[model samples]
Target: MAAKDDLGRVGEQRAAAYLSDRGYDVLDRNWRCPAGEVDIVASRAGLLCVVEVKTRTSLRFGHPFEALDDRKVRRLWHLAHAWIDAHPGRAVHSRVRLEAIGIIGPDPRSGMLEHLVDLR
Candidate 1:
């Protein structure tokens, strides 16, 4: 696989670990539907969080969280609803949330990870 792909995988792993550490129960990874892809689907405080993982070498280009635009948010919202509806247990008292996971690098030496909750 390409180096960028490897970096993305590593970044996703890091994001998962980070979310788990924060008491979020990960229900799925790479959840998909007709709308689009949701990088991580987790629950915290009885709310379902749809996360978008954005990885980059640095902030030179732009903030990683900035990559999730309005269109992406709309897609994620649709997917989140679909996910909740698919799981009857969760649908009763569930709420949808949007988040962004930003990874700074795969450098290992100085890599940084950021999780922005409720982005949308």
Candidate 2:
């Protein structure tokens, strides 16, 4: 995989671990539809969470969370609905939310991860 792809995968993994440690039941990762992709699907406090993870090597360009623009947020909203439709058995009946997890730096152990919940 490309270096960027590796960074994203590791970042997502870290995000999942972080969420799991916080009592979030992670249901999926890289869930995709024609609309777009959701990096993590989790449930916590009776809410279905659609997570978008942004990973970066540094702030040279910008903070990773800064990448989530309005357009991407809209797409993620659609993708969250699509995920619910596709996984009827999972029964995600509670409220749905858009969340963002930003991972900065290369090392998963040392990187900064910021979880911004309820983006929408």
**Positional deviation of 64 in candidate 1, in angstroms?**
0.7
Candidate 1 — number of clashing residue pairs?
Answer: 0
Question: Would you list the clashing residue pairs of candidate 1?
Answer: none
Predicted model with the maximum lDDT: 2
Q: What is the per-residue lDDT of model 1 for residues 29-82, given as tens digits with 9 covering 90 to 100?
A: 887777677788888887878888888998888988787889888878888888
Across residues 85-114, which tens digit of lDDT does each residue of candidate 2 receive? 999989455799999998888685569899
Cα lDDT, all candidates = 0.80, 0.88
In model 1, state the lDDT of residue 66: 80
> How many Å off is the CA of 76 in candidate 1?
1.0
The regions of model 1 sitting more than 4 angstroms off are 90-92, 108-110
